[model samples]
Target: MATAGKAVVAQQQTNLPFAYRQYSAAELKEALRKMYLIRRFEEGAEDAYMRGLIHGTMHLSIGQEASAVGICMPLSEDDQITSTHRGHGHCIAKGADVKRMFAEFFGKTTGYCKGRGGSMHIADVAKGNLGANGIVAGGIPIAVGAALSAKKLRTGKVVVSFFGDGANNEGAFHEALNMASIWSLPVVFVCENNGYGMSTSIERSTAVRSVADRAAAYGMPGVVVDGNNFSAVAEASQAALARARRGEGPTLIESKTYRYRGHSKSDRNRYRTKEEIEDWMTNRDPIALFEAELVELGIIDQAGIEAVREAVRKEIVEGIEFAKESPMPDMADRERYVYTEAA
Candidate 1:
């Protein structure tokens, strides 16, 4: 099978483009596929949004799939993760159901949040996903508390907190990192440095060149990886997860990725330049990077990658049909989840 993202990288090329540990061909291929699926799903949703099929603001993760899957694949079924507003990739990477996620966005009764939370607040506690929070940096402290509970219960489960580059500038970010360090909690802080925090560039928001460098203040391993490279993100994620599992405390992993979409669905993406987006779109795609690796290793072909893409596309298509047919929750039931009348 030929890869959908075919590239002609010679096997004997002397110079490598990025810094990452060597991995088996199979591992690289798998990570790339998951990231590809994530990217496709988000893009599909964006199309649906434009068609007025999906209600509410969606933070499409057209990029940053590597950070989500790379960190998530290392967790056990029992391990927990706290996600961000732009967290469909994280939820999917943690084995969340796409149909149900679609239902949630459509505000159907069968949604993970029971038709109320919509796109930014999808949650599946049973699957160890606490939830995707709308408030910036709100999920960080909650994840710390989850890790603390894991330690107290002796669950041997680690919590992964996924946040954006903008979140690192928040007060809760500093407070959670400090508390987690002092308590030696089993939490992995994954900072997806996607260049912009909402509409603001990272350069204007912070003084530090990388979020991983901030880990130094907390006495933890602060490592940065090319977030477009799935293998690099995965390897670094595994190392951080291993440290958390061993009670060696947490690691601040900064994945330098890019977002190919606007900060939200309505902004029209006026903040960034077309050339900047094109640079990543043409050359820095995560799927393309993995396809090149696959070809060089002689593990798979362009057809294989295309099949994967087609299968995911079919699933997305079916998800739309399912969501549209799904009955909206009874308006009578709307007031049930959030509060109850005084007895």
Candidate 2:
């Protein structure tokens, strides 16, 4: 009788939201930590940039934390991902060291690209990050090529292509999706529809109602998720990942999220009003929403949440300090990595 009752309880637990039921308390807490790290890291970078510590402009992903962390939840380090220009969140979520990222921003030799790639081209190949592309929809075709390699090599690895809604209109986007579907490759296309491609809004640019709608033309499953909600994004990612692993082909996921910052540091945000940005920041903040869910589910308490924040604060401070103290690449070695040397 006790065994039967326990089974019933287990079944009941499965009825909860996908993330709640699928992930353990520890995993969920870790996800929360990553989200916090992403938030703080960007904030720290912004501070440094304003203080003239970093060169070149950067694209901040302040309000899109949930979408990045959630989509990466079901992925392994062996699984590859292609990132965009505004990809610090994705890099951190996929297990990047914040210190190296800061070092890159500071143009130190300790950076992932030895201080050469800076903000837009961070890549950790051993961790399966194919690097962030500067071109719109650039990573989509690269991800398909990587997936093709994985399939041909019989590596059983999956590749995820992360792009913005702006990339949906690009010709490369259509071609990549079509190729992935026709070949039945193990790849997933994730569109982070933050409502704007720079200053242009989606309604003004895209003909389709949703970015996922275009996936049908490529003959793949089109899924739209509340990208601001961590659980919803993770659930969709998990399902899509499973499908890819089964050799069933690609899935296009349109994550409906928002970005609090402008398109880049240069953007004045004149395209949108203060009221709209304020509303999203105040009410639809991804970090706050995820924290609320964690507390409600008893996965973490207020004190625990604060502890995580405190830890992340310390880490961010240490990362900035490390970047400040690290040596910059010497001028004499400027052309060292530019060309390949003969064996």
Candidate 3:
């Protein structure tokens, strides 16, 4: 009877999802909170932009919250990431301050880049978010360089480069992956395949069926996960991180996610059908899916979920207010950070 009970317990433990089995209840709850924060932050940014409080346009990662949070779940504060134009979720996932993010949108000196980076160039170096790049595949090589540095210095740090599917075809992408593989750099290339890159779909652009398949050419592990499912992404991430930490070559993770909003604020979104958009939003929302799992696992109740939502709402409100009240960069200092100052 004892042996039978042990087998049953082992089977039950094996059946639990990677995240549920690996993380504490508090950690899982915190991951849920970060997902909420990402969703609410983007929505708040959209509202502020519409109100003319934010000057430049912003790319919102409204639906792909799980990919960002899950991929970063296993990473340490000392680890690094390079983000794309659609990188707000990545920033929040890597522990960026929402108030500073909002301030950057408002072009305030209190922003991450001191009002220089704005939407697509926010960088928190101390927290290891190298920066978000506006150029396609621009951050890929930078991440490779950072990874090389880590390997050379024996830092034991892993780097994640988050780019869209469109960047997969770029020359830099291929070159960076090839270099990372040859050197066995501690890096993970994350392709957040959100179906459309600007207006063209992946089918219309890339020849490959899936981005992960491309990893074989570079001689690394290629993983595909349902980006909406937090557990799946986290599972893949945990494995990839372990591989990199063991000094194995880089891994490629293709997160099959969808962005509910247009590619950018200026995007007309005429390429995809509204039915498709509604379907993803209604059925496969990352936040909703994660919440359901949390409840099913007995990790959190409805009241706890509502409390998280309320906290995010309050945080978003306070962050926007902070940005609104912050001082903009002085005109006299326009050329301050433009050129390196002499010692």
Clashes of each: 9, 0, 0
TM-score of candidate 2 on Cα atoms, chains taken together: 0.96
What tens-digit string does per-residue lDDT give for candidate 3 at 82-110?
Answer: 99999999999999999999999999999
Candidate 2 per-residue C-alpha lDDT over 22-77 given as tens digits, one digit per residue, 9 for 90 to 100? 66677888999999999999999999999999989999999999999999999989
Residue 53, candidate 2: Cα error in Å is 0.2
- Model 3 lDDT, residue 92, Cα: 96
What overall lDDT goes with each candidate model?
0.84, 0.93, 0.93
Query: Where does candidate 1 have its weakest 10-residue lDDT segment?
Result: 1-10
lDDT of 3: 0.93
How many backbone clashes can be found in candidate 1?
Answer: 9
Ranked by lDDT, the better of candidates 1 and 2 is: 2
Flag the better candidate by TM-score, 1 or 3: 3
Cα RMSD for predicted model 3: 3.8
Where is model 3 more than 4 Å wrong at Cα? 1-12
